[model samples]
Target: MFYSNSWTKCLICLIFIASGNAECPKPQVEGNVVLTNEALLMNDFPEGKEATFQCANGYLKEQGSERITCTSGKWSTLELTCKKKDCGAPREKPHLKYEFSEEGTLFGASARAICDKGYQLTGPSYRQCYATGWSGRPRCDVVTCDKPPEIMNGTITEKPGEEFPEYGGVIHYSCNEGYTLIGNKSIECNEDGEYNSLPPECKDVNDIPLKPTATISITTTSSSTVPPTIRDVNDIPLKPTATISITTSSTVPPTIRDVNDIPLKPTATISITTSSTVPPTIRVSGRNNCVGEHDTKSATENAAVVGIVISTVIVALIVLFILYHSYKRKGSYQMGEDPSRTKELLQFQNN
Candidate 1:
């Protein structure tokens, strides 16, 4: 029991020593401040609290606190800085338009850039701070085109066939009637400023007259007259008026009668009578000349001309065939022989 009590007392003493007021240890550095350890620890200043960093003869300090302090058994953060070695300047991007406060700043800073009106922007807008320095350079990008195609006296349904920011895009062109297309219907715009095909044109359509044929008919009238008899002088006419009045009648001649019982009629008759009648006149209807009529006339004339041509060709073929047959017949006659006489003579000769 005495040994057990002694052990318990020893344990309590150790606890008291561990909990006593020991001072925090200070950090230590030997070379460039930038290379020094970032964190620190303390042991109640058992080895005495202190921290220090020294640059090489030609180098300088950069970020972080240069010296650290210890209080309440804990050490303050160490001061860290970098000295420039004899290295050349860092790589700079030529095309990027940006502003930087320093060649190299601590991590997590930003850079800004501006693009021309026609061009667009892209890529990371800022640089990140890294152990070596700033990381990730800013970049700029050219904007895509939105301009339309310009047509000469014509129009396109779309300016550029489609939105083409990257490469070859197509467009179409068309012309109105009475004008002919002279070039390609579509063209493609290339990055090189050249269009894929040539421009188009409009031309007048050709007008040609069709074959003509003529038609004629009586369009007017003319008249003629026969002479009439004149009366004698006054004395004889007065005597006749005192004693006589005249009447006249005329009848047409009868046609020949058939043997079958048919009525016989007088050949001709004439009588004197007083009457008057206007002479019978003749009239005619003329052809029409309206627009519809004129068009129909033209069509008819064309049809007649076509028919005449076809008939003429047929007649010519017939005549040629007749002539050819006549020639062949004449040729065959020139080589003809009498087969019957030859056969009779052969039989007689053989007998």
Candidate 2:
């Protein structure tokens, strides 16, 4: 009974002491369990230590802490969170209208910008997939290639088609009918992306006159009016006329008596010629003078004797010429009615 009573006294004293001493307990939350709709959560964080948060899906996290607690046994009621938002960077905007490769998730994907129909892109078309999207905005620029017109011989007033950039494509050339091309017929894009080279030229060849033949010519003689006579072998002259005669011998009667006077009778036929009754003998000349001329008549007896003598002499000369020519040729002398022989004899006699 004494032990039991002492134990009861001690238990009452212990209860009073426990009841008087206040108690501090371990933290109620355990492990890393995230609270609802919170980017970051930390308990009993030191004064200088900090925490960061990030959102999932199409949302982006902000800097700084989402929530914090102290060891003073008091929890923070800041309720701040990393809100999902779009924070564009350098190329995030575009000067010209742009389109992304992906719509909501394009923040990390490449984006391309294109100018409108009449516009062109001034900067790079491709943009990098970045954490803060693209950097600078893309710009659209106007392009014009006002190339000069190409002509072979005519004027190059303006360029053909529309106006494009300086470095354009090829241009064609042509020439007029009488003209011909002497330069490049086509030009193309160059190093500066432009066309160059001089324009084409047109030229003509001079006409040549025909030459004349060498045989065609005119010559002036000593007398301008004296004509030339051109003839063949068919023309000759006519023959000439000549005169000739014959000779004879006969006895003449006694001179005619006057009408009233009596005529003397002829002497008795020269009866007295027989005076010397001896027989008469004639001698022939050695040469045949009969073939030539030996007899003669008194110039007073025959008035026509002169002409007859001349004709006889001419005949004798012709006969002698014939004899000489015949003796030289066939050794025989003869006469005929040929006038050429007579003319030849006459020419010889005259010579």
Candidate 3:
């Protein structure tokens, strides 16, 4: 009976040892909290054992202790709170602005870079937040354009000291002498780093048209009651009245026919109109002469004929004057009294 009691006591001791060694399942905490290296190696925790925790990657501890105790095969409630790490704002740059992604400025979030007006972004346009801060370095640069196009017979002028034009820059154009510009004289660089329009052309001034020349005209009219009559030089008749009408373009007075030289019919009427630049002169022979409608001539032609006749008369007068003086010096001035010579002189005067 003593041996049986010893075996029973040994069995009871084994059961107590089993109950004292109770273990808790792998530890689990809310949020980004995770077990330390030493605690994670073990699959389960013994009763009364303590485990330490910290924030997960990209997360930071916010509140409460980092340690918890296991009791009665369960882990103690965890009070540790964690949140994502914030990267804050990006670095400031000239003509550059940033816009955060949907993840905000926290760790692992991304941002896009934007340039201001007349500028462009260079290098990477996107940057991501990391544990060490934002990644990538970007820059904003002014937009630039190549040399402006050349125009025919024209020159382009730009600002001094500039090899190439920048955004918003202006260029002036000019044409050579005797040439006119055909388009805008100035051009501006656009946001795309190009001229806003095509270069202007140079047109020759001679291409312009000139005014037309004025025209000259002539008109004539005449009136008579009976057919024109030709009179003989020997029969002298009373001077008849003549109605003369003259029209001319020149400011100078027109040359009219002498009343004694022109013997016209009583009912004859003459109207002359001319648009010539020069005034016209009219003359008629008195001996054996008659002026009718068909006798009219152009103002220019009449002027030329009158000039020739006046020149001939002047030369004949000079010759007659010299001959008379020579005859008087030779004592032959009585030659005019001879009957035959007198008749010849009268005939010449009539002609």
Candidate 4:
């Protein structure tokens, strides 16, 4: 029983000693201070027990006691003085916006960067303010582009072709007749001063199918005629003859249906009136100056003919007037000479 009692008393003493019953230890250095992240929850500390201390972010210890001892169950007042740690303001970036986690730009503070709309970020999005400087230096810039370049033998399929090609603008290309596209058909203007793809080329067409031709030889010595056979480019004779009608002068090959991105044959039709006949008209010598299919008159020639007819009418009127005047004068003279001669004549006849 006595041994059990003694053992219990020894266990109680160990617990009490572990509960800060000893005197606080002296400071390691008189005035030097060291920063710590540990927390202090107890109001009183036993002798030989120390409490750690540290300077807040953006500040450094100029001088002071890092740890204090609980001498007589009481700690000495803090002698440490914290000085500000200054890092220059975050690197200036034009057109860039920033959001800081803390109000102060002191050490250990962090900031986030965001570029303006239509602009792209070049570096890290978040940066921390260090004692030396900012963690990442970010910048903002405007990406611009001039009018889209012209492509040879090809046209831009974009509607209302824009004069200025801005970032992310897309342009589609297509080759002209008798040419084939050789590269990317669509390209986009990128952030950098460049395009997503090299402009396509319009290569000359070379693989078109060749039409068939037949040769006939007429020999006087041969007694029988030999029929010529029609064949295709592959030298294969086609059977079951088919006939098709066309009016246009164009001879472009028909494109395959849904194959090779080819185009279809033109479906245009032209109608001619059967009863129309050629009209009589004077032809201009220098050029085919006929303005319309129905207009038969030439303004220049019509004016000249009108002037000649008017001149003829005027000359005929003048000639008729002069003839009437001469005939009247002759009749008047005959009237004046008559009477005296009449009497003498009558007398001579009677005798």
Candidate 5:
């Protein structure tokens, strides 16, 4: 009896399926469209029933109706068309530029933020487009550097009101008096927000290397009958009572002399006095000392030049005096011969 009942139900289902009275499978449409919530909840759609559709999450309907009908256990042709949603260009920001993906600004597309030269990106580097809009806000900030490093005995020459230096900006450095700069005088801010090189050092001038020292020695002698005071090159006075004597031996006997009918021996005495204080030693240690030594040497060279000039002048004067005397003698001899010649001419005419 149960097999008879099952056979009867199967016969009825076959009759219904043959008559095209069965429900339609889940309705589907092309172009990224999906069934509406009401339609999706229903497990099946009967013939002659309607199903509504809408664009997918990141898609938008372009044209055609969102409703379709099922007939003969099959869905009707869908006239709906959809396209990707567009987010358009990103917001504008200073020093910020945007580069879009291959999909452009459409739905699911991404954009990357780029900063101008000497600038840094502060926010997220990438943004994605969605049905709502772009993802995040990105910004570009100017690159800056902190205050330059300080140097010993040196100072930075900053602008009037500048506290922090920007990228590519330059700062100059200077040393105090009597100090020498040992590195670059100016450093520039780099793209990394730091100085291009380390700060220079200010070293004392005395620390600089010095050339070899030179020593000079000089000797002088003098003989005089009278007691005389002597002075050094600096004009410092010397003792007046010091005496110096020199003796020489000759092959010939010394000549005797008589003064007022009294015979006397040829005896000579000489005295020479020199400064007692020794000359101060000159030490060339630093730049100032070397300059002083150079000045002294120049002074000595100038004095020597002046002495040569004076000697030349004296020699010229002596030559002029001799020439004058010889000219006068020639003129006198010529004058004396003219009178004698006139007397002889008178005697010849009378003959």
Candidate 6:
């Protein structure tokens, strides 16, 4: 009974001693970091001791002692710190834009990339945040198109032998002489590596028959009045030319006149006018539709003929007037000089 009572008394004393008699203060939290959520469980802590530190989430430990030593009656000043990592701005790419997911450019973050219209993403489209920095460096470039199709009897207008024409680039075509252009005159290279239209074809101008046409223009006076304006809608021809002549009472059409050749000016004019009883007559034997937009509006065959006719009539009238005046002067001179002599000579001849 005596031993049991003694043991009970010693246990009570030990409990009272370990109850953290407030002899040493515990360590407090530091710099936005918290330790275990549990209440201070230490029964007692002696001077010259240590307690560990921990960093909160999304923060890294700085280069310092993670534990703080307890000195006599107080805790040591904190040596450890929690800091954040920063990856500065990313590199810029042409025609491309980027945005970060979070305001912080720290590790484990990401960035989204987008390209402008008519531009394509060539390299990685997205970048991820790493400890060093952004992982991928993306690129942007304009949409590309391949070489246009070759044309038959025609040539495309492009830099010779240049392979690629980017999107929205244009190509023009022109046919050889006597050949007409079929399909589009020009095509555009699109982003799909194809042209907007098929290649144009050149047709032989001589394959279609042409008829004779007559245009008679006469100028009675020297007036500034514009003669009837004409627009030719004919195709242009190529080089190496030869003259062709056709004669008829109707309008003369030089056969196979090169569509590419510029029409020559009339060589000369001739005038042939009949009496007023006859009006000028001009005839066109065939269909007459002049088809040429580029006009070499020099004097035509009919215009030359009209000018000749007017000039001839004026010359003939002047000649007739001069002859009549000469005849009248001769008769007047003979009458005045030979009136007296005329009677005397007649009488002598009769005897």
Candidates' lDDT values, in order? 0.50, 0.45, 0.73, 0.61, 0.73, 0.62
Which regions in candidate 3 have their CA more than 4 angstroms from the true location?
Answer: 1-12, 101-103, 208-351
Model 4 has how many clashing residue pairs?
5
Model 5 Cα RMSD, Å? Answer: 30.5
Most TM-score-accurate candidate: 3
Q: What is the lDDT of candidate 3?
A: 0.73
lDDT of 3 by residue, 1-351 (tens): 999999999999999999889998888756688889988887768999899999987889899999888887888888889889999999899999998889889999999999998899998999999878899999999888887778888887654246788898888898888787777788888888887887777877565344333333446545443323334321222234345555744332323343222222232233347332322233443323534343333433676898999999999999999998997675544654887887776678569
Model 3 clashing residue pairs (backbone)? none
Instruction: Give the Cα error of residue 203 in candidate 2, in Å.
Output: 6.9
- Candidate 4 least-lDDT 10 residues: 229-238
Candidate 1 displacement at residue 204 in angstroms: 7.6
The per-prediction tally of clashing pairs is: 24, 11, 0, 5, 0, 14
RMSD of 6: 22.0
TM-score on alpha carbons, each prediction: 0.26, 0.28, 0.52, 0.29, 0.51, 0.40
- The stretch of ten residues in a row with the least summed lDDT in candidate 3 is 259-268
Query: How high a TM-score does candidate 6 get?
Result: 0.40
Q: Rank candidates by TM-score, best first.
A: 3, 5, 6, 4, 2, 1
**In model 5, which residue pairs have backbone atoms overlapping below 3 Å?**
none
- Runs in model 2 with CA error above 4 Å? 1-65, 71-84, 87-99, 103-106, 115-121, 128-133, 140-152, 160-351
Residues 166-195 of candidate 1: C-alpha lDDT, one tens digit per residue? 235567777675555556777765544456
> lDDT per residue, candidate 4, 1-351, as tens digits?
999999999999898877656555433333324436353444445675667787765567888776665666566666777776766567666779888876457777778898876577788898887656678877775565566666888898882255666667788889898888777888887778577888887777665333333223222221222222322122222233233333223233444543244443343233322222222223332224334322323444676898999999999999999988996665442444576675665567567
Tell me the lDDT of candidate 1. Answer: 0.50
Compared with the true structure, what per-residue lDDT tens digits does model 2 show for residues 1-351? 999999999999998776545332222332222333332344434433333323444444444455444333344433444433443433433336556566433455556677654456776886655445455556865444345554645544334354553334556565666665556666644434346666665544222222332222222222122222212111111122222222222333434342112223332221111111112222222232322122222222354766789999999999999878866674224455377777777678669
